[model samples]
Target: MALLQIISAMAMAIAAPLFLGQPLFTLPVAAQAQWSRVHEIPGFGLGTWRSNGDQAAHAVEYALSLGYDHIDAAHIYRNEDETGKGIADANVDRRYIWVTSKLWNTDHQPDRVEPAIRQSLSDLGLDYLDLYLMHWPVAFVPGDGTELDRETSIVDTWRAMEDLVRANLTRFIGISNFSRRNLNVILDICDICPYAHEFELHPYLQQNDFVNFHKEVGIKVIAYSPLGNTNPIYNGRHGNLPPLLEDPFWKKLADVKGASVAQTVLAWGMRRGTVVIPKSVHENHIYQNMFSLEINFNVLEMYNISQQDKRARMNNPSESWGVELFADLDDHTSLDGNKGQEL
Candidate 1:
């Protein structure tokens, strides 16, 4: 996989100028500015997956003030406009902020990819995104985030994503909620491999195999709900789950380390070499999350955290999607139907 990524990158390096009419190493000033922050994305990020209204805007402002450089959002999150306001209100240079959003499932069609990104860009009031992801590998009903569209192809969708890079709408493009099956497919046909893969990951749902797979293939693994999605949305994935913050085992570890449970968990994730985004709207929580890098966990503690995994997946799709997305997710090796387009 590493060899393939090297080859893919070399091909892109050679082909970029030939196809896009510029030196491969040289992009416009705006693009080059955003590109500089991609390396620091692994430590932490502020997630706005279900944030709403003006509060969402203020929360973004608070996060930015606390020194958070990465903001994870999605078009389906329905708060790009709010987040955009927050980014602007913060008075930070736009280039210094690392913004990521997703392409909605409804926009899986070849012709609709670019349009979906444009709307997100317009809503965010930004000219370009640091990273843009296909929110999910499965297409869905046009208006819903999870109502599956069984007819669309993920491979085709990715081709459109490649077009996004050429168009300079997103500095980099990626996938979220994709299983290994789906990622392998994208790599197979991609002239430029995806920069990262986002998925629901935490101590309880430690997807070690899948997480390691992504890194092995040269894709950075970005974790959403890094502390577990304790907040409910739609039908609610976090409601009845065990409170990771209050878990006695985890708490003991945090107490020993003089770290909060949230910090301990985030530290564990960073130690594993994946970028973990733990969402928060509160000022204290956001600030404490910023200091997570100061927290550390030893090998035994990491083993204990690993032992907490129950394969509990919080972001499973519903029957409304009309596809067996949850049960059959790992059964294939590619999108089979997961084609996509521009950002």
Candidate 2:
């Protein structure tokens, strides 16, 4: 795909304004001064998709202390209660925080959507969510995360999501892990446009085409796993890839700027205009990741990092237990080649 070409061109164009003395290159002084100003909602946030209850709560507290006002969660994570408790502990006004949750793969059937949302709300101890998402394009049988029967199409699920928004159960509703094909299915049938789209995005697996397409359609792109399985010490499932923290290039930049590698990666995502949700249970890492908001990298540095793309995807449906059910996912070539194809 020519995704890289588009990314390269955009990077160069964005740099032009910076080189010409445009104010856009520099971080907004007002924003920097008010960094800790009452739950400010920037494009960076915490994603609780992979953590358990206690860990997620700790992460939330860490994020809150570090000036993050956005928290991404989902029914699949089974940690909404912890996330809610963490928010409550922060003593921040509910309205000040931007909370996002997702409908699971199994809850796509029209009949199952509302009940699922109600369950999530009950679990989260909230009346409404800031944003809700259809977790994936394919629908499964209710109650089973792995049962991919396709009982309900994405359009039908989207129709249900529209109803949720109309009913005020959620302020916004969007999709996750959906290809361009799946997104078109929703657009053709739904009256309301998606507010955002969440997917696995990192330097190695640079989903530039999808990001651009979402931007063109006015849908915000929320990037998950911005740090591509860097620390082998964290979990072995991540497989071995060049750790983001130790990458020679990033380390060189980090040393020059006196910033952490994690901060550098986070800044890269922010520079690209995608909301990054990096999950961590450790307090230090949480603070470290959140501090990325205060740092800004120049165009050349950002371009240098972008060139490190290896298309390494950490989360793949093909790895699930029901291998045959998701066999098509193994065809990485189709995914890599069919840029912007409808689901």
Candidate 3:
């Protein structure tokens, strides 16, 4: 049955390879072109990080129905099966929607890379992924929880990822949660520079310098946790900082624009040239988030938000991973003052 589905999907692709819909996918130019004008992923997408259980599928399906052209998933999320079911349940055509998944630390070994993506494809019920990212710069033993594997070379793992593009399993490749130091290493030697980099970015925790660096290198930024402190995983990690939605400045801005706080921040992320993936299970929030594209921030508003950068990083697992993440950025040792014993 899966084989038949693959054949049918291939036949469909051959018949309609030129996708010129809302979220466009430009055909790769020969060799070097792959490195240039890489992908046209949508500005807004639905995130499936803690979007687990039946709600995960429902959120994805509803988001797509509401005109979300992109969906982000990862193997570590452990909800790809539900995410796939949601995509299949949606009425929209697959060609119009962009799907992204990630490779977990445990699968960073060169030989394990291909099978890792294959497993993600199987769960997502797709013949190919629009983008696949390395979940983190860290690597771990296959079954060991948070046990670092210091021997695996990220260059070799990236080589395997580049091959996925050639094999037509994924259209583009990127990295997530990598600091400036980690990114520079890849930039120095990668055959195909990363097309995008996913990390935490919000009004309160904006890393302006790092964001600029990505722009200088031509890498698209995908902002996860765009709403700030909304993800349950960040329950106590914020250290007394008020929820971003309740910030007086942002609230005033949202009121002025006649938009919700969520909408305002999401628009800010897009206006600054980054992709924003805000997750939600409620139908109302999903509907509101999609229309964030319509919220235009004025020059002053943008400037004011920029001035609010607190450099308060929320999602750092350096201590647990035993490597200093975001080593060169603000709040590098925020989480438990973990200086990365291994590092």
Candidate 4:
């Protein structure tokens, strides 16, 4: 997989100039500025995936106090109520904070969509979400059993999500964990295309081509697990690969930049115009990550980081989900169609 990524990266490095030449190195200031104005999402935000109860609330409150205006939450995270309390406790003006949540797979059915968003609204104590997303491409029945819900087409679910925009349940709608093939499934036939697309992205799994596609279509890219391999949810199949933070190459770069490894990586994502949502319950880590926005990589630094791509995807459930989720990308996993719990 690493060899494949290296070859692919070399190919892209040679051919990239033919498409967008100048911005490839310099951060594309003009393009990024335009995206910022249009997207309105904070380039840096807090991710609340595993944090729950008081912990989740405290993290949200503290992050808000520390100048973070975006909070990523999901119904499946099972901490929306607590997360809302944290937001309320912070006393930050509601208009300033960007609260995002996702609809669970069970709610993919068109009829169940509105009810699900309403429930999330009730749980989060928010009248409307700044951004709402279809949690995943695959769907499941309301109850037990992991059978893929083939009856509910993604186009139907997406149309229902578009209605949420008209109904004002959420200001924007998007998708997560969707491959290019899955996105095309909606993009081919939809009244409103996704405003954003969130997925696993870091130095190791830098899907340059995939990310570029989103850019061409004007879909904002939200990078979850931006720190790479730090999320326990992903048990990598790579024999003994170190966590992204501990990589010697990244550490050396961090030392040269006088920033922590986490900041170094997060800054790389931001420099590329991708919004980074890094999850952390620790105050020090949260503070450091927010400060990543201040760090900038030079053209050489950016190129060096880009060369570190191993194409190692750490988040995948294709085997467990009974369907191929990221068939177009490398996940180091096979689709066995076995039943498994939602991540």
Candidate 5:
């Protein structure tokens, strides 16, 4: 780093923590911008999956003031208003922020797409979103049932999303929970090809072939739920099973690097060429996650993590949603996607 840039970065790093009540760190330009505009993104983002109301707003404020330029949210989360307040609370210009919100499945109807963006913009208190994504590949029939709307094709939804961009409701558009086949379908029919694809990706459930396909198609990969769940131990939501967070490999590596497990996991996510958004409401976790970029890994270390991929997915919605969205996950063959591919 140049003497002036190094000194400037140091000043900002020190000041960020002091003002935000959390430690903030910076990575080199090349490392910071794995994709997208260099210096415009922080690579690590805050995922407000279940965060809500004023508390969720506070998290966003802290995250923004702590030097996180990216914030990933969704319409279904029903907290865009709070997320927006947090952005406002941070006291930063919108141009410096990259706010992403997803379109809910119910709003995938051609007529509802524009309204979804409009409502999100109002809820976020923004005139334009940095990026808007289709939350799922399938459209729901809406109600207490998991009935899939057989008629609303993703192609129709993509066209409406394209309209959103043209109308200046969002700066860019993308898709989430999309398989390789889903991407191919969009590529074949899109006038505005998707800019990114968000998915469940971690060491245990690494979708190598899927990610590679995204790279080949020149679309960015955004990883959600980067940290595999350890609910059995913490929340008693399931049986007492081993959690990936407690894996010996990651723990040992983290110890060697003098970092937390979450930090190392995030660093590995970046190494794989995907920007990771791990959600946390606690102060220490937020700091550690942002600072994870400081933990440097060599080629061998990265390869070792890559080799640990068991193709074990953590977020399978097939049962709850009553749709076979990603059966590749169940069979540990995401490389091939679902048989006859579920929409």
Candidate 6:
């Protein structure tokens, strides 16, 4: 039955590859081109950090329908097969979509980098990744939860990644969850600049300094958790700040635009020119997020929403190995300190 299903799917793809290329099996429409240009992203794309393949597939289908041309996955997500299935199900041109994946903290050592990326590629069922990132700056000796000695160095891991790019395992290489200190370390010794950087961001946690610094350095910024995540552990960090989607101001604006609060939040990211990947399992939410590309806020409305910053951050190093490294993190040059400041 599975083989039969696969054959049928392939038949569909061959029959109408361009016009009906989506996991949702929706017909192509004139609106597709507009959606593509409005929603297309160059760096980070679909993120499946906490979902299984079934859920990831649905999200990918929704993304393709909404005109997304990129998909981001990682070994830590444990859903690369599902992500791959979604790509196959979409029936889209493989060359048209940018696929990104990352090596986990446990695989950051120079020796583990190649094997880790090979395993990721195998799980993703892809020949090569469009971009590959070192999931974190710190390295962990396999099976241990602690970082290696300070002298171990990400520079060695980066060297391996540069070789992977040269060997065509991936086309681009970058980092995530890296602080300015860590980034500077890599920049000082590495030969190639990172094509992108991924970090948690939201209206309250604007991350303006890091964003500006990376832009100045020619590194694209990819915003994760743009919704001020409602995860309990994350909420605990901010003393359980109110959800941004439930705010009265956002609700009013949603009503005015006839869109969901989530959609409005995504539109803010799009308008700001940041590549955002807001995760959701619900079919409706996925479609809603994809359609957010069509929603536009007025200039005054954008400014007013930007003023809503309260310095509320959802992700922090409170429980991570580097918690101590960020203990005195009050400079506020990043999102946690600078609230209500203009970009």
Which of the numbered candidates is closest to the native, going by highest lDDT? Answer: 3
- Report the Cα lDDT for candidate 1: 0.75
Off by over 4 Å in 3: 1-39, 334-343
Q: What are the clashing pairs of model 4? A: 322-337
Give per-model CA RMSD.
Answer: 9.2, 11.4, 7.1, 12.2, 7.3, 8.8
Candidate 1 Cα errors over 4 Å, as ranges: 1-40, 141-147, 233-241, 326-343
Determine which window of 10 residues in candidate 6 has minimal summed lDDT: 334-343
The residue pairs in collision within model 2 are 180-342, 181-341, 181-342, 181-343, 182-343
Q: Flag clash pairs in model 5.
A: none
Report the C-alpha lDDT of model 5 over 248-313, residue by residue, as the tens digit.
998999999898888888888987789899887777777668767766789899888878886666
Please count the clashing residue pairs in each candidate, in the order shown.
17, 5, 0, 1, 0, 1
lDDT of 1 by residue, 1-343 (tens): 2222343245445545545543456467455644553444535788997677887899998777655778888988889899999998886555456889998889998789999999998999888888899988777667745555666798888999888888888888999887666677788889867998888888867888888777778888998888874555523544455677788887888888888888888889889888988877788788777667777667877777788886767666534344444333322222223232211
What's the distance in Å from true for residue 156, model 1? 1.1
For candidate 2, write residues 1-343 as lDDT tens digits.
1222243245445545535553455443233223322232348788776677688887887676555678898988989989888887775544456788899878888988999999988887677777899987767776645666544677888988899877778777898877676677788877987989888787777767678888888888888888877634335543555666777887888777778888888878888989998888888787667667767778888778778877666665543423222122221423223221223
Local accuracy of candidate 3 as per-residue lDDT tens digits, 119-159: 99999988788899999988888885888888887777888
Q: Which whole-number lDDT from 0 to 100 does residue 321 have in model 4? A: 69
Model-by-model lDDT, in order? 0.75, 0.72, 0.82, 0.81, 0.76, 0.69
Indicate which candidate wins on TM-score: 3
Residue-level error in angstroms, candidate 2, position 115: 1.1
Error of 1 at 6 (Å): 35
Give TM per candidate: 0.83, 0.79, 0.87, 0.85, 0.84, 0.79
